[model samples]
Target chain A: MKQLKIIKIGGGIIDDAASLAQFLHLFAQVDGPKILVHGGGKGASEMLRALGIAPQLVNGRRITDAATLDTVTMFYAGKTNKAIVAGLQQNRVNALGLSGADGNVIRAVKRPVREIDYGFVGDLTPAGVDAALLGALLGLGLTPVICAITHDGQGQLLNTNADTIAATVAVALSEKFVVELHYCFEKNGVLLDVNDDNSVIEKINLTSYAELKEAGIIADGMIPKLDNSFDALSQGVSKVIIGHALKINDSLKTVLCLN
Target chain B: MKQLKIIKIGGGIIDDAASLAQFLHLFAQVDGPKILVHGGGKGASEMLRALGIAPQLVNGRRITDAATLDTVTMFYAGKTNKAIVAGLQQNRVNALGLSGADGNVIRAVKRPVREIDYGFVGDLTPAGVDAALLGALLGLGLTPVICAITHDGQGQLLNTNADTIAATVAVALSEKFVVELHYCFEKNGVLLDVNDDNSVIEKINLTSYAELKEAGIIADGMIPKLDNSFDALSQGVSKVIIGHALKINDSLKTVLCLN
Candidate 1:
């Protein structure tokens, strides 16, 4: 199988223009057919504040009301995605930006209202990803840069999680390629000591992952992230890497495996 | 040669929700391969007012400053483009939204300044439109929905005119297909009397266009639009149709030919 790397970058890198440029420069050097999935930065909230819309939170969870969804759609799908695409074009990489609505690449269902209404938030599964279209795009020598906006087949746009989108797309494409999912964030790696950035864990298999959870090393936010990573590994993903966005090409990062 | 239609819709139909929906419904029924190019709606100006940006006009021409470029990019490429794509998807058309930066589809140069500088505005030629890529996308059964934002083939995104882009794309694709260009707006067609909607000129050839201009029937703002349409017709476009957006499938329209 051909090797494919799918990298997910969060706001830590994207919010900083210089950092985002440097990351894209490094990403352009990765030698393979790859995909880049980016999360929303702090730009959306800043624009919302400028537009005089207060953050609408219900029971401590942010709600994607109609206005919020519009603001974020403009930010994620419009400004940031185009910026990255233009930058990649300048770097000589043929990058194509995508929202789920474009070509129905990711047909997500709107999250059902249970206790709190999330307005336009989208929920996804592996089946929702269009592997054939993505494969054809890659075959045409175009690297796809995806943003965090998805759509319902009926016409509503929804705000979705970028991490979940990356993992879901990775799982969906793994059947055709040896997929390596990279979660690039602010930290160096899964650190042994949270305060000490240099205390990076080299590798973690299923046994070590269970021990880390048992020993309370993996708790709270990291728990869910690593849990999803392991789940992808079991679902035909060849590997998962967690590291700083700027240090993606560096070897000093945490690697996860099913073994 | 195969037949292809390229339709350009401006703010008249786009600003209204019901009209835009009706137009997309009519557009979905257009036979054979088709492309949709949309202009920025009034929503962008309203958002600018809410965000406290005054319009900057020099010599009666609106200048696209840095802030104005950002706002327009968000509106044209982000919100409006995605909305149209999702709407077309709902109508069972596989629409793929695009900026000129995507796939380097339309590489534009920044407009040079003589008296006043139009910051981040792009100028295009037929050579800039990637006809082969667009043809391949159509071969894949995808309809390209383009917006008025383009890139300088560097890292800068620029605001462009939607009408020009549509004409240039039609001329470029005419090499492989019998290209028909449609300009959809509020009016029924080219009227003999500007005030009479029923006095529509059904067909206009080169000779009739010259006689109409000599009689002062086509003057003012329409001179430039028709001039460009005739230029496209001379450059290989098979036909140019001017009609109302909602009445696209109707027989009440103006057809321009080089004969």
Candidate 2:
């Protein structure tokens, strides 16, 4: 199988122009077929505030009402996505930006209203991915830069978690390629100590992941991220790497495996 | 050559939700491979107002300063483009959206500063378009939804005139497709009597188009549109149609031909 890299960047890097430019410069240098999935950064919130739409949150997750969804869609799928695509073009990378709606690449279901209504949020499953379409795009020598907005295939656009989108796409494409999923953020890597950035775990397998959790080193927010990472490894994704967005080419990162 | 329909929609249809949905349905029902190009409507201006950035205009044309370009890029390529794509997907059209930066499909030059500087605005010729990539996309059975945001291929994104985009793309793809460029707007067609929608001329050949311009019937804003239409026909586009976006399937439209 050919090697393919699926890199996911969070808001921290996207929120800063200098960091994003540095990251894009590094990303353009990455060899082989690659796809970029980006998160909705602070720009959306700022726009929401500017538009007089109050930002709603429940348990650290955004409650994407119609107005909020519209704003985020504009910021993420529109501004940020195009900026990155144009930047890549400057570097000679043929980057095409996408929302899940574009080419129906990712179809997602609106999260059900249980105790809390997530409004227009989408919950995606592996089957919802259109691997063939993505494969065809990659075959076209076009690097897809996907935004976190997906559609229900019935006219409704849903706000999805970018991390899950990256993982799902990586898993879907694993059939044709050795997929390397990179979750790029502000941190160096998955840290062994919360206070020390240099306390990188370096590597964590299923066994060690459990040990880290029991030791409370990988508790709280990093827990869901790691769980998601391990899940991808279990489902045919070659490996999941978490690291700083700017230092993607560097060796200082945490690698997750199912082993 | 295979037949391809390149339809361009201005802000009138895009600004209204129900109208946009209706137009998307009609677009999906059109036969053969197609492409849709859209203009930035009032949404960008509304956003600019929200962001407290006063819009600047010279001779009724926007001065696309850095701030204006940023807002317009978000509105056109991001929000409007995605909405159209998602809507088309609901109609089962399999629409793939693009900005000029995506796949370097439309390489533009920053408009030269002359009497006025239209900051970050792009100027394109037919030769700047990437027809092969578009043909490949069409061959994949995907309909392209293009926004009026193009790149200089060196990093900067420029706000382009949507009508020009429609015409240039039609001219570029004329090599592989018998192209029909449709300029869909709020009106039924170009009115022989400016006040009467029923006064559509139905057909205008090259000679009559000039006479109409001289007679002051097809004057003002319609002049540039018709000029663009005639230019496309001369460049091998099979024809150019001007009509209401919702009434695309109907024959009550002005057809411009070289004959």
lDDT tens digits by residue: candidate 1, B1-259:
9999999999988899899999999999999999999998788888878889887767645589888988988888889999999999999999999999999999999999977798888999999999999999999899999999999987999889899999999999999999999999899999999999989999999999999999999998889999999999999999999998989999999999999
Model 2, A1-259: lDDT tens digits are 9999999999998999888888999999999999999997898898898889999999999999998988889899888999899989988899999999999999999999999999999999888998998999999999999999999999899999999999999999999899999999889999988899999989999999999999998989999899889999999999999999999999999999988
Clashing pairs in 1: none
Alpha-carbon runs more than 4 Å astray in model 1: A58-61
Worst 10 residues of 2 chain B by lDDT: B222-231
Fnat of each prediction, in sequence: 0.77, 0.84
**Candidate 2 deviant stretches above 4 angstroms:** none
Per-residue error at B252 for model 2, in Å?
Answer: 1.4
* Candidate 1, residue B230: lDDT: 98
TM-score of each: 0.98, 0.98
Q: How does candidate 1 score on lDDT?
A: 0.93
For residues B44-154, what per-residue lDDT tens digits would candidate 2 score against the true structure? 888899889999878877889888888898889878998999999999999999998999999999989998888888999989999999999999999999999999988
Clashes of each: 0, 1
